[model samples]
Target: MRPLTPGDVRIAACREGDLVALDRHLPSPSHPRRYTRQLAGLGTLLVAWDGGQPVGHCEVRWDGCAAAEVRGVVGDCPEVNGLFVWPESLRRHGIGTALITTAEDLVRDRSGPRIGLGVKDGNTRAAALYVRLGYRPAVPRYLDRWSYVDQDGRMHDNADPCAFLVKELG
Candidate 1:
């Protein structure tokens, strides 16, 4: 597949009917209903669309980082959480970057001081992408916790030993 520039993807906050489409496009744990925090004003789920097809997604947590250590150390600010690109699109295809840039834009529009994201310790590729995008380590480590509901409607919780990264937005 050819590389996609950021412009190739259109990013927008997830709409009410988008849940079904996103869940069908993204992976299992990537179920859009799982992060429907937009309904509560906690955050907005940004979906990257390519010609009306959902290609990727990321949640802009306007409330703050959910990780305890990140909250305590990074303080309250928007957090770019749960970014995911469809495996078919893969990394470096610009989908992930578009999703992140959109998340940053969301925070920046809110006059947010900065944004934080948690990366699994061993995910060097993703961490490197964040670094290249101007994110730096906000905290050495943290427990990133999340849960998702499967198609069968079973709830699954997860916790990951992750490193927190933050980027100062203008």
Candidate 2:
């Protein structure tokens, strides 16, 4: 998609009704209802919308990683996890940046010392984005604590090598 200007998209905290409104706009090959339900109970889920279509979405985990095993991976750092930009065509247009910015704002307002996030070891593109935004790797070089539910309602488990990154956000 063409680069989107600030006027072309708006980022806001997702409301309860957005779960249904965004049901059809989720990334392909994924079940919208499952994603909607997951975000519904997770920490704040933010959405980037172009009028009525959701182009991107992300979640902030106040307590820790959703997985119980990695709860203190960041040691009290609020995590900006589950970042996704749908329709592939809508990426590289600053939507992800805007979403992260909003997340930082949310964290800062809560007086968090810093924000944390994890990137798959193989996802160099996403790692670069986090670096550009000033996040640096934390200890625990590689973690297998990443897990999530898939579209089919199946609990999938993966020990994908992941690195935890953190950025101080006074």
Candidate 3:
């Protein structure tokens, strides 16, 4: 396989037609519902593609922060949530960073002055990445709780201690 670079990735909001492939590469069939949400003007599923492969994704909740503690703190600024790059071998090759910066650009294009995201407390690596990207602590730690069903039909209910972080776009 050819080595991947930042230049090799193309990031864009998940379109109606991208749902099928997204359902395949992404964790679950949630992309379809996410696409419906996108169409309803709620949030967007931004997908990062490397050539023909869907390599990463991050949801931009344009309405406001998804975390309860950070919600009203940043007004209506978009939130970058659930950023992921598949295949452990592909990490640190700029794909995750590209997804984040692209999300920022998209929000900045809409005149958004800031953005926010929640990081699970134990996820030091992700927190470091957010800090390097200029996000700072915004709210006191809170419970990060959610549930999801995987492609295999298993349901997961998770709750974690997390912190909300925000960054001003320059």
Candidate 4:
């Protein structure tokens, strides 16, 4: 597991190329532009590489507020967002945990006491992964209430609801 800087060779700053990689791995291109813009404004975007190929990526942001805010939901804490590991790379090693740990450390360096993220309801695997990493549910589970249509002509509503999970940085 190697750590990559923003413009490193294997993990160049997430430009159009990395966006292609991300689209291929994610369930849909629901918010790639939004995520790209966020990555541009946020501190750093970390991508993991296997043999010099981009394999996984995560984004970390510092809330200008003394508190954290995700999708307009604000809290008195720092947060991490847009963490995704390529499906093809799951379980081959500890890449996902490494990414999360890196995000935690970055937030901690900023004097953040806690970090938080929201996981879609039904993504049990991701939720479980967070739990195993010491994150616990911190906000009431609620329906997302937003909707989008995917490339497959399928509609998904944030209505599926999500649990906001948080981890205290020590």
Q: Model 4, range 1-170, lDDT digits (tens) per residue?
A: 45543334243245556656555555445447446656666445666665545567766655522222334454545555567666553543677777778878878886578887778878888888899999998764755456677779999765546777878787
Tell me model 4's lDDT, rounded to 2 decimals.
0.63
In order, candidate lDDTs are 0.80, 0.75, 0.83, 0.63
Candidate 1 lDDT over 1-170, as tens digits, reads: 66667777888888878777876777555544445578788888888887778888888878788777778887777888778887664557788987888777777877566988889989999999999999999798888888777789999888889998889987
- Which is superior by lDDT, 1 or 3? 3
Model 4 TM: 0.65
Q: For model 3, how does the per-residue alpha-carbon lDDT over 1-170 read when each residue is reduced to its tens digit? A: 67989998999998777777776776665576667778988888899998877889988887876556666566666888778898777889999899899888888898578988888888999999999999999876877777888779999988888888889898
Leading candidate by TM-score: 3
User: Candidate 2 residues 1-170, lDDT tens each?
Assistant: 45667568899877767776667787433334334544665477778998888988887876656544345556657788778987787788789999999999988997577888888878999999999999998744565554457778888666766788889886
Cα error, residue 114 of model 3, in Å, equals 0.5
The order of the candidates by lDDT, greatest first, is: 3, 1, 2, 4
Weakest 10 consecutive residues of candidate 1 by summed lDDT: 27-36
lDDT over C-alpha atoms for residue 69 of model 3: 63
Q: How accurate is candidate 1 locally (lDDT)?
A: 0.80
